[model samples]
Target: MLSFNTTIRKIHLWLGLTCGLIASFSGLTGSLYVWQPEITAALNPELLKVENVENIKEVTILKSVVSLIETHKDSLNKIFLPYREQQTIAIQFKNGKTNYYHPVTSEFLGEKSASISFFENLLNLHRTLGIPQIGKYIIGTSAIIFFIILITSGVYIWWKAYANNLKKGFKVKWKAKKKKFNFDLHKALGIYFFIPLIIIAFTGSYFTYNAVYKSALKVFDNPNTHLINQQKNKNFSTLNETLLNSNEKYALRAIYFPKDKSGMYRIRYIKDRFIKAGYRKTKEVEINEKGDITTLSDFRFDSNSNRIVAQFYPIHIGEIAGICGRILVFISGMVPLVLLITGFRIYRLKKNKGLKKK
Candidate 1:
C-alpha cells in the first residue's frame, strides 16, 4: 500500500519552505475579508444611516444618490447599488476615481473609503498582488501549491499524533518543551482546520486553474449542465423586452444587473430542476427602470455544470453561507494564523534545544 504521506511529505516540505509565509498571509487577509462590514462600520460610522426609513424604495434611494453623485461625476460611469445585510442604500460609483453616496435625501456622504480596504489590499497581495493576467497566474499557482502543503502537513501532523495513541493531541501541552509544543499546536490546529482549509484551497484552486473546469466537463459526462449557464442574445433586445417576453419556470430569488455593455442582467432562482441540475439562470438580459429582462429572443439560462462551478467559490467562501456561515469561516481563517505563529515558535525552541545537546 502507498504510504499516506509518502508523496505528501515532499510536497508539503517544498510548499511550506517556499510559500508558507504567503499562505499564512493569505489566510490572515482572507479571515479579515469576511468581517468587511464590521470594518466598514468601525472605519466610518457615518456611512451607515441609522434612521429607520420605512417608505424607502431601494431603486428610488439608489437613483437619488446617483443623481447627487452625477452632479460631480467625471469618469463616474456606472454605479453598483450596495447590497449588504444591514441598512445600506449607498450606491458605489466612480468619478475620475471611486466614491459612494446615500440613496436617502440624496445626501452627499462625501468621498470616503474604508481603512479596512487595507485588509483587502493585503488579501489581494496575498492572492494576486493587485495585477491581472500575470498576477492572476502567479497567485493561482501559489494557491494550488498552498493547497497541497496544507493537505499534506495536516495529514502528516494528524498521523504523527494519532499513531502515537496520544490522548493530548488536540489540547496544548503548555508545559512541554518548545519544539514539541509547536508541533502539538500545528498538529492539533491542522486537524481542526483540515476540512475548512481544504475547502478554501479547493475553491481557490478551482478559480486558478481553467483546465480543471475543462476536465470537469469530460468527467461529469456533461458540458456546462451543472453551471448556471447564461448566453447573450444577439437580438439587441432591451430589458423591458425580456421582462415582457419570457415567462420564467421558477420564482426568482434575486437579480443582478451588469452595469455596462457585454454585462448581462442575471436573475437567480431555484426551481425543481435546480436540485438535480444545480441552479438555473436567464441568459444575460438587458436592464431597465423596473429591472425588466431583455427580449424573449435574448439568451436563456442553460442548466450546465459550468453554472454549477460558478456557485462553488461563493459557497465555499461562505458567501452562500449567509451571515452565520461567514462568521464560522471567519473564525476558521483566524485560527490558521494562531496555528502558524504558535507552531513556528515551538519549532524554533526545539531546534535550539537539539543544538545545545549537539
Candidate 2:
C-alpha cells in the first residue's frame, strides 16, 4: 500500500494537472478585473470625468436628458443619472444599446458596443465564461476542488519540509542550482501565500456559486431580504429625481427604472469617500411611480451576515483598501499561474530522473 504522504503527493499532482488550465485562465482574467475602475475611467474620461464641477448644470438637465431619450422613441429604455460629477449621463435603449452623454451639456459622447464592454466582458469571462447557469456550476465545482487542493497540498508540503529541516521548509535558496531553485519556488512560495490563496479561492467560489454563499448565510439567520412597498408606481422618475437632489452623501452609480406600472425603481449608490467603504458602504432605495419610497437598504445598517456577504465583491477585487489593496490582489491573482508552471516543472524533472534510473 502507498504511504500517506505519497498518496497526498499523487492527489496534489493530479489535481493541479486537471484544474490548472481553468485556474490560470481565472487568474489572468481576475488580474485584468482588478483594475476595472481605473481602466474605465482612463479609457473614457469624457464620459467618466467632468472638467468643471463648479459649472455643473441644475436638475433641469435631467429633463433635458429625458428629452434626449425621445430620440430613441419606441426603442428607448431608461436614462441612468450618475451622482458623481465626473460621470456622464447614460441612456440605455430597449434594444440593449447604451449611449454616454455629458451630464451638463448632454452632448452624445459615444455608445457602448453590444458585443461587450471591456470590463464587463472580462467579468463575465471570469465568472461564467460568458455562459451563465451551466458555466457557473463548472467554475464553482472547480473552485471547491481547487480550495481543497490548496489546503491538503499546502499543509502536506509544509509539514514534509519541516520534518526534514526547519530552514529547508521556510527559506528558498536563491543561489541554488536550477532544479533546486524550481523546487523551492513551488514549495516555499506556496507556503508563504497559502492563506491568501485560500481566501482568493473562497471568494471566487462565493461569487460563482452564490446559492452556496446564501445557504451559508443561514447560519447567521440572515434570510434573503428586499424592499416591498404597498403603494403603486406613480411618477417614479420624478420621485427618483427628488431623492437624488435631496441626498449629497452617496454618489449615484446606477438606476434601474420600473419595468411596468407596478414595478419599483431601484437606485444604487456608493458613499462619496472612504478607503474601505466606497464599495462596502452602499445604499439602495426602491421607489414606486406613485412617489412612495417602499424600501431603503444600507450596508451600514445591515446585519453581520448581510454585511459579510456584502464584502465579498470588494474583497475579491481587492477594492477594500483602494489602490494598495488592488495591488495585493493583482499579485495574488498571479500566484495560481505561477504555481502551475513551477509545480509542473518539478513533476517533469522528477519523472524523467526516475525513468532514467529505471
Candidate 3:
C-alpha cells in the first residue's frame, strides 16, 4: 500500500497531467487577452477612432443617438458612449449588429458582428473553449480542478521542504544535474506564481458559477434592488435632457437602452472625477420613461459582499493594479505552461528511474 504522502504526490501528479493542457491554453489565451483593448484599437483604427475631433458636444451625442433611433427604431439595444476624445460612439442592435459613429461628427464609420471578431472568439474560447452549449461548464470544471491541483501541489511542496530547507525550495539549483534543475525550476515557478494562479482560477470560476455567487450575496444581505421597471415605452424626447442632467454629475461611460417596452434605460458611470473609469469605480443608474433617475448599484455604498464581487473582474484582469498589475497577470498566465513543461520533464526522469529499478 502506498504511504499517505506518496498517495498525495501521485494525486498531484495525475491531476496536473489531466488538466494541464487546458490550463496552459487558458493561460496563453488569457495573457493575450490582457492587451486586447490595445490590440483591437490598433487593428480597427479608422472604425474605432476619428481624427480632427477636439471636443465632443453633448448635443452631438444626443443627435447621434436620436438619428440612430430614427434609423434602427426599437431594434436598438445599447449605445456605448466614447470613453476618450478620439473614440467613436458604438451602438448595438437587438439582432447583434454593432456600429460605430464619430462622436464629434456623427459620421458612420463601420459595423461588425460580435460573432466574427477575433478577440470575441478568443474571449469565447477562454470562457468556453468555443463550444456552444456546455463549454462554460467544461471550462468551469477545469478551473475547479486546476484550483485543487494548486492547493495539493502547494501542500506537497511545503511538506517536502519545510522541515529540511524552506529557502532551498524557493531557489532553482542552476549548477545541479538536468533532473534536479528541472525539479527545482518547477517548484520555484509554482511557488512564485501560486497566488496569481489561484486568483485567476478563482475569479474565472466566479464568473462561470455566478448563480452561486448571487446566492452568497443574498447571504451577505445584498439587497440587489435593481429590478426592471416593466413599464411600456414612452416618448424618448426627454432622453437627451435626462442624459445632459446626469452628465453634469457623473462621468458617463456607457448607456444601455431599453430592450423592449418593459426595459428601462441603464446608465453606467463614475461619480468621482479623480477615480479612473474601471469596473471597481463604476456605478449604475436606471431611467424610466418619465425621466426619473434611480440608483441601481454603487459598490461604495453597497454591502461588503457587493464590493468584493465588484473587485473580482478588475482583480482577475489585473486592472485593479493598473499597468503593473496587467504585466504581472500576463506573466502569471505563462507560468502554467512553464510548470507543465518542467513537471513533465521531472515525471519522465522519475519514470525512467523506476523502469531501471524494475
Tell me the alpha-carbon RMSD of every candidate. 6.5, 3.9, 4.1
> Which regions of candidate 3 are displaced past 4 Å?
51-63, 84-86, 113-116, 217-237, 247-249, 270-279, 288-294
C-alpha RMSD between model 2 and the true structure: 3.9
Please provide, for model 3 over 129-149, each residue's C-alpha lDDT reduced to its tens digit, 9 standing for 90 to 100.
998989888888788788876
What tens digits encode model 2's per-residue C-alpha lDDT throughout 193-272? Answer: 77766777788889767777877786875346442323333433565355535443565556576656687767676775
Q: Cα lDDT of all candidates, in order?
A: 0.56, 0.70, 0.74
Q: Put the candidates in lDDT order, highest first.
A: 3, 2, 1
Displacement of the residue 130 alpha carbon in candidate 1, Å: 3.9
TM-score on alpha carbons, each prediction = 0.68, 0.83, 0.84
lDDT-wise, the better of 1 and 3 is 3
TM-score, structure 1 vs. true: 0.68
Error of 1 at 308 (Å): 3.0
lDDT of 2 at 25: 77
Model 2 worst lDDT window (10 residues) = 227-236
For candidate 3, report its TM-score. Answer: 0.84
